[model samples]
Target chain A: MCAKDETSRPKMAKPGRSFTTLLFFVCCLLCLLLTRGQKDERMSICHLSSCGSPLADDGKVYGMCQGRHGLQVWGRCCVNVTENTHNFTVGLDLSGCNIHDEFFQESPLLTLTHLQALVLDNNPITVLSSEAVAGLTELNYISVPTHSNCSCPGGEEAWNHLIRSVNTTLCLKQTSTCTRYNEACPASSSHCVEDGPGLFLCLCKEGYHGYKCLRQGTFPMSAFLAGLGSSTVILAAVLWVLLRRHVKTA
Target chain B: MASISQMWRQLKSKYSIYHVFVFLLTFFSYAFFHATRKTFSNIKTTISSEWTPQFCNATEPCLRPEKIWMARHLFDSSSDAEPFLGWLDSTFLISYAVGLYISGVLGDRFDMRKVLSLGMCLSAIVVFVFGCLTEWIHLYSQPVYVILFVLNGLLQSTGWPCVVAIMGNWFGKSTRGLVLGAWSACASVGNIIGALLVSQVLDYGYEYAFLVTSAVLFAGGIINFFALVPSPKEVGLPEPEDGDDDDDDSEPSGEEDENGVTPRTPLVQTDTDPPVTFTQTRPQAISFFQAVLLPGVIPYSLSYACLKLVNYSFFFWLPFYLHSQYGWKETVADEISIYYDVGGIIGGMIGGYLSDRMKKRAPTVVTMLLLALPSLWGYSASPNNKTINAVLMAVAGFFIGGPANLISSAISADLGRQDLIKGNSEALSTVTGIVDGTGSVGASVGQIVVPLLHKQLHLDWHWVFYFFILMTLLTAVCILPLLVREVRSMKCFLNYQLRRQAAALVQDTHRPHSLNS
Candidate 1:
């Protein structure tokens, strides 16, 4: 087999050994190399019909699409935006829509945590807790301001602090949820500091912190006892099984 | 004492021990093959995202290019990177297809254990080097990436034939369909693992995808080297009766019984005879063309080509289509697409089990391919509901996965044992290689054509799916001749039996008349 291969090798190398063959190979190589450098054109979310309301809709707000006018919008609704929203959807403008609490609850916006600028400028929406607005740490520009009726559990002072931490220029004030302060802070808490007419801050005496000052700071003795009991039971069961096997063998 | 003794006995049993080792070692070894290949899709996405840095930057200025796609000038000069990336995949696949043929030949002549392990190790080294070029050193040459991928493709080709041939040696024809079916799921398992690994590490650095995958391949190679026994004889166990052992002069004389049949050496020795020392020779290697000429080889090969085309198109493009057509988030699209593979795992087992029970490989495959046509059409035309899509994807997966697994593994094994080959066991690997090699060519074509079809159809995903529906129908058609032949043989068999019964009745009447006379 080795001798046969050796004889065959020289025969192949002897023939078709021309400059043109080498040139043809080089040309093919060149074409592939040239084509490799080419890059695909970037796709824009603004071009997609799912990014904006259809033109046939009764209320065609330019703000919904960031004032990019004259773009063609077919009759495709953004029905499955969580599954349909483009990865590059940074600026979402739902400014003039009457988006109530149900809108937030039902909308797929929560899944689009990659958003950079979320503008709910003039909507009649009230945020009751930081929990409602959490998980979107990637947001650079959030505009749910006092003017838009957007408020949190913490009053104007707390809202301002939230805005500062997010590093956005949106100034949202405390809402009616703060005015009903008796129910806001837990009864077992120590002091409630009112910043404004509608806003109050809870100050727990000790061994407690949180929005309602309801969370106990100390570790739970019951959980410790339960863990200890379970471990002991498991250990005892294992030992019993081992002992039974050993006794039988003996 | 009784419990301990029982436990030890169970461990010493054949079905409970050695066979399980062979099954797992082969299963994971092939899965590693798929795991390494699975990284391509994720890497493709990374390349596209990186090429459009300006767009990504506009979305979020802080976002950086994936290190895997940071190789300069590869996609920077062109208007679209899809064409180039498609070609890169094609280069790998074409080389792979070519390498499959060569590897099959080598596997026949050489020790499969070494071939498979060395292939894995080389594949690991190539992938590791490829990753380092992209991530650590940032080597920015198109030729470098292309050449490395092509090399990896050739190395990757060695896995399927070697594992299949080794598996064929252990399990008999009776249980082959079911065993191979379960075993074939390594591809889907590897796909899930690869997809998950890339997605998880994608945020950290794209290079880790390749780095981690290379590590897996290396570990698999090491395992393959140590754990894999190419044939049952290597471990002093009985080779399954495939009717080929008579022609196999490779076994030492000491192992042969009085009738000259080598009795199956039990995996665990019950008798206290001293361990037999035997020098076993290898069966003569069959030629490539001869292996291809074996009965059922050509038709199955052609059919497998089409099946692979459809399957691989989904493997590479399903996520991209979901993302683009429905405007789905990349991650969500990736998650949803795994349903296809999940469906495939179940489909493979079903296909294998059905074929085994029916004892007709071609007809079983034909049924699967026929069923798959409607599933593809339904999936394409169905609404973009997640639950509906999930159901449809699984159903499609079952039908397609069944035939794909059946034809390549069990059917190939059956064909390799055809009387035309004189039951030469060494030819099984070569036949497997030829059939799957042909399929890999279709896979290569799929990698190229799917993208082109997507381009030609103006990026409408519906038309792309229509093409798949057509391919499924074509695959069913390829198996029609085989199904026809099986039916005819069955009819002939029935006719012969009826004639013999009629003759026996006549003989009974004539005997009574003669006795009376």
Candidate 2:
């Protein structure tokens, strides 16, 4: 009976210590989850109202923008009216704006990723290239000035239909740029995706990343996290024991 | 079982457990205070980039996909963002300076352990909410950020006074210099820890840096609440004698010898007295006005103000200067700048030891401050070689940081326990608060003035170094009166010692002659 009592006491003490350690880890995990679960509430829109000039309240641009469900006319740009939701520019009209070719060289319009229909009918832009309109992935319809030699954003082959009117040229039926650029990517380990109207980016497939996507396997994040957590706990325990011994001795 | 119990008893008798515990507890508590404070400086660049509008240009034609927040639109241009960031720093420092006076009084009146731990916990929450939760929730209001920082500043002010007063309560004058000197490194250590943690998790996002630091601070606060014993009296141990009673007797006479030197006879007589019992009743807390009037308080505080201005200017601008002047990467500049803090740690320990050995604080401080001028000038003149820059920077740090640490910690402790206060331990916190509070005000002014000198005045970086040299000279000048007194006292002390030795030798010869007769 005496031998059994001594053996059972050691077994009981082992679980008690482990239980507290487990509890500490559980609390840390809960804190991390709580902080991570918060909803992102940032307004996504153009920073300034005047991309150039404010649109008249009763003008054609305002009418066209107001007809959309969540769109509003801010200067020359059509952006989301709602401040809370995550949204971006969907329409822009720069007709008769007198903007030059240098404007497209480092265009702010590239940030309007959700832009669908763009009107550039009366501008003096002469050097618009596929590179200038890059990152405008959702653009489907675009009207260019008649005298300018600017092609459709991704070139003539990218659009399914093109109409040359008396005053402007309209391009429609935008096709995916990835289909044409897929061959540019590494064959086995990577895939190509359209980043913008004329830009295609090659992304490494699962478990591959490096100069040529030759490297394999992702970072062992779980192992690293586990190691970090356990080490912190161990260090804390050691410090506690050391300090406690000093207290006990005195 | 009997042998084990006997061993435990032997170990208990050998160590002063409460002393070690108090030191570790206060050291880490103040360290956590500084760690939370340092998180903002480390993440400033990242915050600026995130706040300013990004444009896709000819060289870089890709939109940042993860930039899906209003904070990106907070400023239309980088120029607008820079001034606002500067304002945040000014607000924190100004509020911190104001709060120090209040915290000092509060620390004396209330239980220090509660004040310290609670302040830590609240400050941690403020930082976590402002830097982390705001990022998570994408809250970009400027006023909210300012308000949170103000509250954080006030909470942080509780840290320094409480920790210093607690150290004063535990340790006596004999070991205060060395102990507090080493303890003072907690700030530099905290800054290094904060920088390392920020750099480690900063690649993930700036918010992660805030999360890690605040979490560490909160954990430290919880430990402090459980473990800390604010004074030796609480644990039934006799409080260490402050050594002020000996000075108390000499100060009243105000007598000088014929050569116009204060006699050191009384100071020598009390050196061999038995340890006094802890029988004096606790004194009431001193008012701010009274604390300011204490001997050595004004000189030290004024000197500290000038010294802190120079020190804080280097702290705030070093990385920016290194990056801009040398064209180094921001991270590389930041990593290199830590050499300054490492030098500070070593300088503080050496200065403390030297002052303790010499039994004079003001002379040691004045010497270091005087030396800092040359070091500062050398750092400015050196070529842009990384090794040379780092070495000169460390040398400047050693001279400047040494005196700053000595004044704020050991000197503050000395003044708080001076004989004029009649050994009132309650006044330590208030005295510490006054000196450091004044220093913070100087630091806040430096933060604003340094930028104005560079940007508005167009003095350039080299010219600004000249301004720092001027400030170092002014710091030495402020303490010149105290230095003179300490030197005079030292001369008298040496004279007294020589005369005593001669008298003892004569008595020995006479005793042998009398015995022969």
Candidate 3:
């Protein structure tokens, strides 16, 4: 009876479920089309006369555009940005820009072959990826929300992933705690850092010490004692010679 | 404790051990002197790089520019700065040369050990002050540095003459050549050690180089005072019996003798008689002019002057020249230049050994000088090939170092034993002083001229080599008259031998006839 009831319940709910599924499929199709259209509009806008212009900040959005003069469109600076001009930009400061994976993948940053520094301060960018910095051959430094101490979900992991993927130095805002900083250790030294039980501990190599392995290990006490011992013997010999000369003269 | 006299007697029984100890002491002491002296040359590149205005300024500040004390005043924008650097070197060398004669005379008159210790102590003080001027004192005044360096130079001059005299007292003329030649290598060894020390410490700071050198010199001076037995008589041992044509009148102080003491001399001997004593009595020391008039003294002195001119030029300018000509790194150029010192060591030993075996000091020196000429030309004119430059440089060093070492050591020792002096050993220091002093003057001139030609005259490196070649040729020529005298005397001796042989034959024939009659 239980089995029969269970089977009958599914049969009754089937039609409704099917209708719902169909409706959901149609909604997804519409949303996808709309998203495609929006993407097309965004790309068209990027390619147009103000292709590299920074997006306007209406007390909300913050983005930089390679304007006629330089990187512009920061609140008030956006107004003076000359229109109908494009430049081969070298740097992009996207401070306070609300960015995501899509913004990273589709942003004009990719077009700037000469980009050196990327500033993403005060941003809610939680989906940074290697693709964002992939072709930036000249990129040397990158700044992120680490400075703003913004508490975004998976923000630390996002920065870690991005930094791991890129070769340049990632300048996290001063608030970011070093989880696994390799820079703490010099090339000649080995070091270990202990955060917690599950956290990996960095162990320094021989003849080096400290969490960062900055200080070189000193000579062993035995070596110092040996040096002292030899020096004493030599001093004694010198004394013996001097005394002997004195005795002879006397 | 045993009575000091008893202990001393026990130690003196092992007189040969004392001899070896004294030898080692003099060797290391002079080497220490040279090492300290060379600290400046070894770190010259570091000084120039660290202090040059081009290396630091308001617009383009150097790494830790504040740490440099002399940068703004001594090495900055004035066009005269570079040329004045040459003068700094000259100040030291000229003072050293002038101080040579005075120190030599003092060395002869005073206790050698006292003189050496005093010199070492003063040098250490000056070098330490030089370091402090840059490090702690921060006195960037150039003239102050020059004055300190001049004092250092004068003190350094005390090293060579005093060490040679002490060693002369220990070893006789028989083994003097090889012993002094090998021993004179203290210069090159000290130079190499200095280069290594300065190179290592330069990473920390340039001032440390001078400080470390001073510390070593101070320690060495103390050790030298304790360990050095300036004369055998002071240790109650008989004099070494190694002088030319001198017969031993005193009992030979053999190893088998249970007691170390030898009896007093039998009698006073005339000047015409063969020297028959290794007596410890103070002999009349010759005047400086008399020492200069000794056979082979003037020629060897002149030759040494030229040789030193060439040597000092290389000493002061080789690394700089290599850097400018080939764009090599300063450290690499300095490392390569050290090989020249290695060649010098080998050359000095070879020259000494050959002179001893051939029993002719002048010819050996002349041959080495002549060989150096071609090597100098090649080293100067060679293309910027590292391998070729290194080999030629080593070859030039080998030849240049040979005569330079021989003239100052074995030749001076030989002149000091001049037959006219009648075995007055104290003259050794004076003769060594005169020869090395003249050489020091030439070294001073070389230190100035190399820079003048390179920077002021704006001549190519080839011109520097031309100066070297001319000096080499002149050195060989300076000794030419002596070489001629040696050859002419050899010819006369051979002729006399031939005539005697013929007369012997006739006498033998006459003896047979007279016996039959």
Candidate 4:
């Protein structure tokens, strides 16, 4: 009778168990689809515009896009495809793109954290504030229209060299934004460090932690040493006893 | 009361008790010395940041800014303290290399226990004053730091030769490889201890790190001064037998006599046959020139230098490489780099055991070094996988560090008591110093060259790995002659064993026929 009941229980629960199993698979499928959609949205930035037949000579940006290995030109952008999954935008040439101050304020280019060489020559943009290049820490070479009065992101002092040519004003070697915000960390136990262009972070000193860096104290050295010392003594005594027979005495 | 007295007498009579005591005392003494040395590297970043003038502001106002009011204010505008720190390191290395030669001569002449304890105590005080007292007193002078580091380097130089000499006196050649291999892990252990102690106290102030390490080192020095037994003769125990007579016990019977490779001349008679009065004669210490011309000293020293260059490059640059390449946080990178040292400790033990089993040091060292090339190359080529990187780094570390440890500890001990030295244990300290001093110079050169290759020359980071591979290859090349000799001796030994077994089998068959006749 017990065997018959056990055999019948599976028959009775099969439909409901199958239904839950189907639901679990459906939920997993939905998660995969959502992640795939997000990935597509991220990759769409590369295909937003088409590349010109003869790429405009934007100096370093053009050279990087054309000459660098593992980097391919994709719709006016030089994307790094070395990792296969994550395509980092390393160089972007936006010559004659009709970009303005508004485009700098809320452009897709701001999402490219790894952007190094950016060319915005022949654009309508006149003034580029520090906020416009806020997250671009790796940027070393940037070009603006020659008519623009916008100095470098953190001003001329923050850059190594500034060149004014016929079509563009190029800023080379943008030093860290920490140079301008050197005194940002006000607490005695904190220091300001550069995170990116126009970005700074406050880090607590070594022993100090928690809110405003007030917490302090060192490792429990006394307790630790006592434990280590006692264990060593015991082990040494054991070794002495074990090797007694082997030792040659006078 | 009677039982307690009897037990005390029994313990005192056993020579093993003294052996254990000396091992523990010397082990901790050297570990303390290394811990103090390691503290500087661990706290370098904190020191550099504190040195920067910009660190002085409204709220954090640099501690005693008036103290640093010099005419030049060299670090006033620039936030980078790397170049100054580099100069400090170079100053220490230069002084340390020079001091090692002098310390070697002094160690053989003086009581080793006194020399070791005094050096440790003095170095502790210097470190404490340089690191901790200066912070308390608000003394911030560049020249003063340089002077203190130079002094500290000379004092620290006394540590290695004295400890190695003392160890050579206590341990005989039979188990020297296994014993010293295990013992040599003090350096890596010291590094870990320093890092832990510093990390614990760094948040309060960098000075606390120095304070703790110096205190520990000072305590070790005091203990060593009171309890250390420098040699067996000091306590009226029998001197250990050198490998000359015991070689046959561990190997085939006829090998040593037939090949005449290693001279079995018992220069110092063992206590086994007749009780020789040790007080009647003492072996004189060899000079620097004489020690240098010893059979295996020059090649081993050169090999050690090349091996140390590669070892120290990883020691100095591993964290920086991890942070830059993998974008790991500073602390994470530092923690990950420790796996290399862990691999080193294991490798040293294995290398020692293998050399002891084969009764050959050079072959084991050369094999590990040759294997290191591929591990290094694999480490460089492995894609940004943390597990793979760590495993390969450990493998590279094993291959590199195994031979380096063997050469410095057991090989140094072996070379010191070689047949040419005539069992004059007094020369042990000088031989150890020459090898280690040359290795320190090589490490200094590496510190300069590693930075030059990647930073100054503006080459890719991969160039550093290529240079490491080259260094590993050079280390093997330097030990090639030693490897050849060891291999030839081993072949001869094996042939003798095979012939003896064949003769025994023929004798077994002829015994029955003779009985029937």
Q: Which candidate number has the best DockQ? A: 4
Model 1, span B1-517: residue lDDT tens: 9989765543333232346666877788888778777787667655454444322233221111122122344464335777767777899889998998999889989888889989998998899887644646656566887899899989999998888888887776656888898888888888878878777665445566777677777767766665566776554455565532323323322322321333232333433533243226666888888888877788889888989999988877888888877788888987888888878778878778776655567777888888898899888876878889889988998888778887888778777766555434479888988999999999888887777767764667777777788888888888888899876765666577678778989999899999999
**How big is the positional error of residue B131 in model 4, measured in Å on the Cα after superposition?**
0.8
Stretches of candidate 4 off by over 4 Å are A1-183, A187-250, B1-15, B55-74, B244-247, B250-282, B500-517
Clashes of each: 8, 2, 10, 3
For model 1, give the RMSD to the true fold.
25.6
Q: Which residue pairs show collisions in model 3?
A: A52-A66, A53-A65, A54-A65, A146-A173, A147-A173, A190-A204, A191-A204, A192-A202, A192-A203, A193-A202
Interface Cα RMSD in Å, per prediction: 18.2, 10.9, 11.6, 9.6
Candidate 3 on A1-250: residue-level lDDT in tens? Answer: 2223322321233345877556544543554466564323322323343224444353111233443343443221221223223223444555544555456556445455555456555556654554455445455446555422323222344233344223222533222222434443233544434221112123456755422332244424365446645674596386445422421231
* Segments in model 1 whose C-alpha atoms lie over 4 Å from true places: A1-250, B1-16, B45-74, B77-80, B243-267, B270-279, B422-425, B457-460, B494-517
- Tell me the TM-score of candidate 2's A chain: 0.61
- lDDT score for residue B83 of model 2: 87
Q: Calculate candidate 1's fnat.
A: 0.00
TM-score of B-chain for each predicted structure, in order: 0.83, 0.87, 0.82, 0.86
lDDT of 2 by residue, B189-282 (tens): 7887887887777655677788788877877776776667676555334555564332322321132121122111212323243223323345
Worst window of 10 by summed lDDT in candidate 2 chain B? B258-267
Residue B433 local lDDT, model 4: 88
lDDT of 4 by residue, B1-517 (tens): 9989865544333325566767778788888888887899888866765554444455442321123221224366334567878878888887888788778878887777788989998999999999989877768788899999999999999988888778877776656777888888888888888888787777767887898888788767766665676766654355554543323544422332332322122223343544332342446778898888888889988888888999988988999999998898888888888888878878888988888777788888888998999999988897887888888888887998878888888888788877666555468888888888888888889989999998899998889999999988999999999889878877877787777778988998999999999
Q: Give the lDDT of residue B15 in candidate 2.
A: 26
